[model samples]
Target: MHIEKNILDNVNIWLTPTFDEKTQTEIKEMMTSSPKELEESFYKNLEFGTGGMRGVMGVGTNRINKYTLGKNTQGISDYMKTAFPGEELKVVIAYDCRHNSDTLAKVVADVFSANGIKVYLFSELRPTPELSFALKYLNCHAGIVLTASHNPPEYNGYKVYWQDGGQLVPPQDGEIIQVIEALTYDQINFKANENLIEYIDAKIDEAFVKSTIENASFDTPAEAKDNLNIVYTSLHGTSIKSIPDVLSKAGYSNVNIVPEQAIPDGNFPTVKSPNPEEPEALTMALALAEKLNADIVVGTDPDADRLGVAVRDNDGKMVLLNGNQTMVLMTAFLLEQWKKAGKITGTEFIGSTIVSTPMMLELASAYGIECKVGLTGFKWIAKMIKDFPNQKFIGGGEESFGFMVGDAVRDKDAVGATLLICEIAAQAKANGSSLYKELQNLYVDHGFYKEYLISLTKKGIEGANEIKQMMIDLREKPLKEINGQRVIMVEDYDNSTARNLFTDEIEELKIPKSNVLIYYLEDGTKICARPSGTEPKIKFYFSVNEPLDSIENAKEVENNLDQKIKNIIAEMQLQ
Candidate 1:
């Protein structure tokens, strides 16, 4: 294998004394024995995208190691000083169960504290959402969480949050990247300011639990809660720290935790992946639900920002709901609650992503509120809350199993969302219906909608180029028809414009520029193609819907919609 000069230069820099001895040895060993791996490790500097960075843990510039994280923290510290001049700077730090997350977190804290920033470090592993909450609660300038939510065991990540408890977005993210890019690894200050670091545990945890319970609980009767047998799993992540307590304090007593997955372990030994979005990840929880005859089964991803839920269908069989289904159910419930409280004063809005189901628009229309759609990540959804001060953000969710109940956290919160889902399930049950039945009713009232996601993973440099080319091809030669449905309008988010195919009229998109494209068919189907900002994959989202005349035919309508999605996939050759 031939290595580029720049890559070799990067590798040689790591072999120098500026880096630690162990990292140097690993570099030399890779050079002699594994040139391909060595080339892959240093092909390019790991990108710090809009929301921090995540990659496999290794001894290279392109990996998540002590040095990479140290460089990032040092740069962020420098930028913070300029962004907030002369104000006493403070930040909160939290880590997940990933290997070396604690040590890496300490490294980050060391850099921040060295720069005279006060640091509140979690004494134990905590969920990513709590980090968001803790930052705002402590009145800090910024926050950092060391977690790779739902990624493989070999991966780790660092996500940067602003003072508003949301991930970095737009001009701030771009500016920070510029500052970080101008520096070398040797510029990192690893010296610790011992007095500037404080370990926090009980007080913040108590406050976060209280806030979660208060925001998510909506006066469900105690009998309804007791009758709803619930099975919960953390999937070897950090949700166990807060969810159980939140549920207990919210007056839900009958909860069973999956014994095999209850303990926090980064290895995620119980399942193929710790992602609750995958059915396999919830296998153990599903089994426990069956054994307990539970009414609902809930599981959160490793960092607990996203949750996957399973509810009893009309046939008395447990069925797992996808991210979109969960989001629709949750968002609609929140809107109804707000309406009941007479809080919907026409200034409230719900948030979702462009790639999410358009059914969200239907729900928003039904409730007489605006459903503001942004790019693919929850950071954009969080930005919606910050961008609109006067408009009340009732709640929002993405198609990726993440939901934020209110503005308290400013990020996707599984703890609060879990409590909210349980409330919905319990109330539905008390009203002579189940969660699944309520879904069917929703479909009948609105329209039967089905969504499916196709994600293709390509690894290494070659894979990166391949994914880029795939997007380019999609843009250069746009699809005119999908499954014989005429393409009425095309939304190219990269250019921030939508073109009406029938009229050839171009209109500006108010959302920010992103590498995403959506096609609207004449028959009301929506297809969106977007490359993953955090992972080595490209995702295609298909949403197909039809009018359901009655609840009796909901299942058949859903099956037809599912088939429509499959047909579109086959037509696009995405299989």
Candidate 2:
């Protein structure tokens, strides 16, 4: 329950800070509230790791506040000067509707401006993808978005992007971390230089809308504009302002919005979690879809960077599509369209996370092109594109519903996804096909693939230790089978190697070391386990596949796959 010593003491001398009355009052309140809570809040500064700084909003070193934001900005500014000295460095900044998000964004802008960097700041709320596009559109050196994606209302974060407009990667990520950890709290200049910061608004949005639609457009129109019924919800976040407009511009006249969930409320009034991946989160949207008798329903997370979708099946029952299904659906639609246009001259390559549905790889192979798999983050996908400058990257996505469809931006793009999903729906309807039918078509041709994701949460001080212990236990004792099939191989991403139990062989994985474990079964089952870097939880991904026959039995086969997955997890005792 105490501070982890020697772990971060090398920077202890920089802990003492100077702050104003509001910040002082908050800290004093925390100090008076159970000495244990104070240590938990101030024992260490919020981390600037691969995903940038994310934590609960509070007034301490371990919390996310103006001071922490300023320090992070100052460190980024310092690193920028070294990375590009004597150059006019500019950073595009955007924020979500999270508590004090705009205030923290302004703190970031002030720190950058004080460091003599140019700032392209949003005058109002916008999706995180727009921030990524702004970096490329404005030709800024990097970008930052103040959001924690779908995390709880109490959490906020700072996501750093590179010149590529994606999250920072590789040597740069490590270099920035080093720069951030070395800064003295007193050295960060929080003074505003308003003259250097420009407030940006809808003008940028106009450009984003055009680029998003143009990229998602097809050669010819599908059916009548009102033929498709679509329902959408922003989940009480930032997308409400733009999604309707985007769909209208894309020629979808029957788009219906979930009235109650349209507003940008940080409390997320209706749902336990704002994440669209949860069925509960999509309850309101689905109800509206059912009432409107819509063809498709969709929702986005708080920042609108991640997306979720659902559609009606042949049985007339509505079901939500997981991240993998969404990606596979989108990829199949896009690739088929582009191939018909002859846009891909065999030089194009697409990318997705290794944890994403393997269905994409099969889909890509069917088209006779390359499908590269990156680590579980889109930063790695962007890195792959950057590493191969000559290869054309049509789209890339992760299993978390974060997708970047065009080369114009490096981050996951909800705008592009919005238009793409609508287009896919239109294409299906025009071809007398449903999204479910198209998915089954792919399954029938390339074999059926099913995937599942499970997350285990650990809370408070004991949670971290418990997660660590779980990882230790898994590594020490490997499972021989998952639901009857013999174990084929185990890929321990932590050590960056895959071990084949049959041959007693070990092969190197291309990516760097990360604390992840994967257990593969001979029957095409995959289970991936990793502790969350920011939150107090561990996530496990399960994937299993089988053959697909006639569409009539697709439902039964799907239920079978679901039960098989459950049995596998039960054998593993994750239940």
Candidate 3:
């Protein structure tokens, strides 16, 4: 058995009297029996990314354990004190259905309470959005949610939120990271001050559900609501309670739950990965929908922040719609309802990520509302809402199956999005159409946009280095053309600059600096390359669009766009 000096040093620290007996025993066993696992577990400390610190659950600094969470919580507590001196410090905490989520959440609460900060922890498992909502609804100084968000069962995470109900942004995220880095393991205060801890459940749930119902608008007849059969699966996550309750409250009685997935299980036994974006995750739901002859099938990820939808196509077959299509449908539905209700004031706007379909921007323009593009995360969209305090945030979504219907919660809310999507289906049925048909109508009016995503997963430290090198290669050697289409412009988000390749003009990008590069083609085609900040993966997003003259032309136009994406992928040697 061999070990690097740095790894051995870190391991020796864990074996000291400061660590728990269980953890020390595990480290000693790993050292004597599993040297490889020991090396991987203690090689490095998990750093905070755009979301937060997430890693495999184990007894190591590189893993998500009590010591790491306690250190981060203490840092947050210190920062809260510095940011709000002479004021009562309060924070909300929630967890999802993951292994050790509940236990980890209690540790977070203990650390916060030990620092004299008030903790409003959920009595049971809850979705990520509710934690964000509780942060603002309770007027807390900060909040934390224990979730890995659609990751494998072995992973867990800690997401920090601010008073604005959004994830920490800009200087705050950096400052908090500095505070955590400066602290040692022994410096963490893990003592629990039971007096400062309060269990919050029904009150916050009631408020969140009420707000969700208030945000829903349905112009369809009563029969439409009864006729729209919706099959919802929470992927064994937290939405099992709130999503159904909200739908029932909104007059949706034809909803069916996948009995297998309804029960909250930390292991997510029913699906290979609890992510609805994966087709396999929705397999059970789709089967149940077919058996019941349902109209729509919806699934939410483990934390209930992202949504995935399957709609009955024109051919009477159940087909899954990608994230962009779902976003387009929901965006169109909300805009139409607003116009009908006369709520489309000029002071309203929408938001999406730059990698998302550009049709969102076009749709907002048609409704006389501005659409803002941020970086890849929902936190940026929330930041947009915070930036435009005077403007009403109608709704926003991303290429990932995450959408926020209203401004009540600052994160991508699957609960509210599910309700609104069901409403869209019911209203479409009342208008002598289906959600699939309404999507076609949107294309007829707003042009047909198609989007595709290619994610190359690279694991471990070597994989992380490979992803970094991929980004560097793409940035240093810009693409001049793709599949015969001339590259018109290149936007380097890291440098905050956009270069017009044809005109040789450079302009400043007003968005925050990120490690992303986008290439614009002459025919309105776009290609984006971005590395995942939280995981060891690099993703490439492709979007292309063309005019749809009528419903009959949809299939042909869609096929053409699909082929175009395939051609671009082949030409770029992405496969």
Candidate 4:
């Protein structure tokens, strides 16, 4: 019922004439009628995280609004001018189908154009990966895409990409944040220079689709493509604009779109959430797949940077694959493609997150390539491409439903990934195998690995404190065992140290510092605790594996692994 003094002070500033009349009126209404909402909005400034800023859309300091994004653009404009002095600084802008994304993108473009930076804006909504491709294609200094990437309907976001077409990382992200922090909202230049802004049309789209098809297709026979019955859905997001085009151009003619979820609507009327990671979001797509007796079903998030896939199991029933399962399938398929082409000469590598199944390392070893594991987020995987300049980046993905094929687009690209998965499916079908069968083969060759994710969301100030305390407790009073499995090692990414519980040996982690902790069990199970950098949630990742002697017992083995995870969760009292 009571608001803090600092929150009240922040709110009162928004009521002044310095802000627009509508914003002022909204602030006043929140203060008088809904103090809790006002507190939530003005308690703190929305942070520009390493990837970018994302929050609910509202008239507050912690919201994604014109002034917040305008200030970010202005800061980036200033930073780019300094970073690339005396050069013709250019930036590409794109937006998703989120509400006000178009207007907000225009406002950002106006800020950049007003600052004398040349701007190339997408004439319409496009996939987030295309924006990354266009940034490098245009040889621009930076890129911005306005998308919440499958968050709730009330949310929006801004993600900044560098010249390498990867999201901002390390020193650059920190430097930009410092500059933006030094300025106020009024300092943003909203004036537009029409001459400096150029709207790009279908030319870039054609180039992007061509590049995706070229990079993803492995020359599957035309008969195989025709035999692969595919059902696709955009989940009421931006993929509707380009997915079908890419699939068609790639010579796949049997693609069926989920009609109820095909339109690009910000309201996302057809699903509970636009995120493909959630199974409920794919209900309509799954139904359509069953009706058509489709061999595979593919769905993309709002921005199309991530995808969720479904394939028929050995029993001939449609089953949705988790992010880790999809990652494993895609990574293994790409590695095999490279090997078959004699491209695996030992300098090639793939990228994955630490929280992902360690099966990636097994796959990498079998192919005689390296698996570079980084912290969570595709940005770090993108960093891998930039970090290892000489070694080839075949493909990479995280436990989250994201995959990036090759280095064409330095972000997770569902557009290209969809085509790549189809190639795998089509080729397998032609060879008397299904996608699920290929996955089973992978598990048999390289030990069967099962992964599960649990996210605990705590909202508002009290929730933030609770999450912080939870991490502290985990550090101070560490778990020695889970479900009677002895803890063999503990990896504290926050402290950048890995301790061997048995011998008490500590070694420094050679990666960037993140607030993540992982425990390795003697039974080859890995448990990780990490707080979401972009959301108000703490995620626990569990990976358990077993040696599969034969594919015949794969089902029974998988069931035991599933029960093991459930027992571990119950033992940890996380339920």
Candidate 3, 1-575: lDDT as tens digits: 67899999999999998899999999999988999899889999998776788889998989999998998998899888999999999999999999999999999999999999999999999999989988999999899999999999999999998889999898899998899989888988999999999999999999999998888656556788999999999999999969999998888999999998998888999889998878999999999989999999999999999999999999889999889999999888888888988998889988999999999989998999999899999999999888889999989999889999888899999999998899888988788788899889999998999999998999986888898898898888888988899999999999999999999999999999999999999999999999887777899999999999999989999999999999999998989
On lDDT, the candidate that comes out on top is: 4
lDDT of 1 by residue, 281-351 (tens): 99999999999999999999989899999999889999999999999999989989999999998889999
After superposition, which runs of candidate 3 have C-alpha atoms over 4 Å from their true positions?
A: none
Clashing pairs in 1: none
What tens digits encode model 2's per-residue C-alpha lDDT throughout 91-204?
999999898999889999999999899999999888988888889899999899999889999999999998988888889988887887888678889888999999998889
Q: Relative to the true structure, how large is the alpha-carbon lDDT of every model? A: 0.92, 0.83, 0.91, 0.93
Give the alpha carbon lDDT tens digit for every residue of 1-575 in model 4: 87789988887777777789999988888878998898899999999653589999999999999988998999999999899999999999999999999999999999999999999999999999999999999999999999989889999999999999999998899999899989887788998998999999699999999999999999899999999999999998888888899999999999999998888999999888998889998888889889999999999999999999999999899999998888899999998888888889999999999999999999999989999999888889898889889999999999889999999999999999999999999999999999999999999999999999999999988999999999999899999988888999999999999999899999999999999999999999999998887788899999999999889999899999999999999998888
Pairs of residues clashing in candidate 3: none
Name the weakest run of 10 consecutive residues (lDDT summed) in model 3. 213-222
Q: What is the C-alpha RMSD, rounded to one decimal, of candidate 4?
A: 0.9
Q: Which of candidates 2 and 3 reaches a greater lDDT?
A: 3
* Candidate 4 Cα errors over 4 Å, as ranges: none
Give per-model TM-scores: 0.99, 0.96, 0.98, 0.99
What is the TM-score of candidate 2? 0.96
Error of 4 at 134 (Å): 0.4
RMSD of each: 0.9, 2.1, 1.3, 0.9
Residue 309 of model 4: what lDDT?
97
Evaluate residue 329 in candidate 3 and report its C-alpha lDDT on the 0 to 100 scale. Answer: 90
